[model samples]
Target: MITSPIWLPATLFAGAVQAWRTALQKRVSQNLSVNAAGLVRYLYGLPFAFLMLGLYQWAFAPSAFPALGRLFPLFCAAGGLAQIIATNLLLMAFNHRNFVVGTAYSKTEAVQGAILSFLLLGETLSALSWVGILCGVAGVMILSTGGKRMEPADFVRALGKPSALCGIASGLFFALTAIGIRRATQEVATPDHIRAALIVLCCTITMQTVMQGVWLFWREREQVSRIFLTWRSSGQVGFLASLGSACWFTGFATAPVALVRIVGQVEVIFTLAFSHFYLREKMRGSEVSGLLLIAMGVILALAGTMR
Candidate 1:
């Protein structure tokens, strides 16, 4: 009986893996359109998602294959499409700024999730949790400014920039995606969290792959060919994405979507480290402060969950 908030570790793992996946997807975006690069995560991950399902069935539950409920497909489709839209918007933002900054904007997903979950799922956050969510949002705002100091007017102006708008829009869609997936997982008829996660994951990935594939086939065949030509990188993106998504779905099933996403904001720290070290990007004092704030927010969120 593991009962010490399993969603905590699951969210942590998802955050780390997602940082890697997002970095890879950013690289993939260099060669493909934002939509095409976003599609690669689904198209390549479809097989690995199925493999994960097979392993779960074979190793974890040999005889229990839970059938999908009537509402599962609707929830899954909504989540899948929302994620695709969010990814495309995020990748498009990547075109305008550094990797960490581009992703930092989308970190607003945590704050957005808090609102959406409350309205849609009747979920409420503790006072400390609200503080944590606000801290996380503050951190993202600081980071998204790319260390540039600005006047109040300039700060307001920055929010109106195209990349900033994309990032904010991505956050909103991602919030919806998280809520939809949580709903889908709850609709499952199984007690096994792993099985439920895998089922939802396989269905969601398949839906995304088909939807993106058909769109690309008609509108961007050359990009489709480029995806295959760059299979090695695309495969890395797919594997990391599948692994991260499995963890995310499991976390979503176990906890409130807002909490899961708030904890997942730790990905910005991971992305910051990746950008500084691997991507050889320089970090500024403001960015460092933002990272520290994010760390504090994550700690506060976890502490709230413990209450």
Candidate 2:
């Protein structure tokens, strides 16, 4: 059992799992509408989420279930809805730009999350952690660009495009989602971060499933049928998404949202590794440098946490 803070390791594990989930979702996206693809994560994952909650309770708190506070619903709704919007916006971005550029723009979530967390939750990071956050962001930018030589002016111009706007908007909503989940977990009257995380995860996933299911039923009933038709792949997405989300929520419960997100930037690195080994893609020098920078940033952040 995690006797101390599990934020750092939890974030790393979540990042790795999320990378695989994203890859699976990308395949799912090919066969489904963006909204339908996004729904798969919640719709298929609902059962697994409940199963996880039951397992947690049986293992850790068999005697009593923690009572949900009044604020729990509000927090869950905010987080669940924000995440759905963010996912849709990200999927829309695929139509506007290439995957690399879209991902780079969306990666601004770390910086935006820091700002939002401070404004909304009054959370502050140490100077070293701030440096880590910046470094991690830089590393992600480098990886996303893949060492392409675009002029500064061209880069600035690209930001004005619709895809960039969608990416930025998605990042903002993602920041809000993280903040809301953290707030929800905090509102739980339990000291067990695992239990709190599980409760919040179950509630959020249930709400998301219902919201997305209703939309699919009315607007895209065919897509709903297609989702079940592709359950084999969709199930993989759901399982990984559910596990990654549980780790992410647990990390949020243990640390400030901004810090948790900064550390979570390691997801880029994991994606790169998958590309290199599975996709057999070669990494460029800039990509290597970016990885090093991300490592340095994560190390600094971990050191800061030790203090």
Candidate 3:
């Protein structure tokens, strides 16, 4: 049996909320431009992120708020900017002819995250954890293929496509974001992991809001008003995005970044549910097998942590 860890539940919650938030964001995108849709999460979520930080500070009453170290801002900025770019790349992939190829390659984040975490932070995972990561990647790849069987040669060729390259790059940047944030949390001068995470979350969100807001004003000025005009939906997306981010940041603070991301593979399960029920799509046999592999990967990763 897998023992309970705060990171496990935190990551799981983050993954579920993220899958839901993405769906809502897509709906908002239909009404707004891609950049505007991307901005909504940070722009509207800014207030809630602050609210969460304030509430946590009040409730916990840490003897002293953690002081941000010199490296804190650097990590936050790097992580924040990486996330923005990664998101844009993922969105760009959706516009490609073979979008699924991009989506599948993007799912390589778990593996990429592991590698980057090791290189950047010297974090190491167990042998089992590595296996779990590979399994999750394979599962995501299968699902991304929409259940189609691709020969080894075809799979290699697909990776050379423009969409595939975008997806691969997206995953790399996302891995960087995770590594940067995790390192940022470690830079705080406090023993309270949650408080450190909240501080980072608030700072990163504020920066992202400002950065994205400027871009919207300069390039997509027309969509600026539409963002607020569709506040009902945009607000919901913002709230969920903030809530999900809180859990993700907490996970990063409390566990190895790679392990947290490995568990986050569960997000695919939520995505599958949305496709089946919300989109009225049928589940393919390959998707079922992929789901099983993802579940197994999560279990193995979690179990490795326990041991």
The lDDT of each candidate is: 0.85, 0.86, 0.87
**Each prediction's TM-score versus the true structure:** 0.90, 0.94, 0.95
**Cα deviation of 243, candidate 3, in Å:** 0.6
Question: What lDDT tens digits, residue by residue, belong to model 2 across residues 1-307?
Answer: 1234777788899999999899989899899987798889998898899999998799757748888889999999999999999988887776775555676788888889989998988887888888888888878878778688655566567777878888889889999999999999988888888889989999999999999989988999988889989999999999999999999999988888778887898888899998899999998999999999989888887677666
Off by over 4 Å in 3: 1-4, 60-62, 274-281
Poorly placed runs, candidate 2 (over 4 Å): 1-4, 98-101
Clashing pairs in 1: none
- Residue 70 in candidate 2, Cα distance off native in Å: 0.8
By TM-score, the best candidate is: 3
What's the TM for model 1?
Answer: 0.90
Model 1 residue 300 CA deviation in Å: 1.1
Candidate 1, lDDT over the whole model: 0.85
lDDT of 3 by residue, 1-307 (tens): 1222677788899999999998888889899998888899998898999888888887756366777799999999999999999999988888898787888889889998888877877888888988988888888888888878876577578888888899999999999999889888888988777778888998999889888989999998998999999899999999999999989988898888778887898898999998899989999999999999989988888777666
Higher-ranked by TM-score: 1 or 3:
3
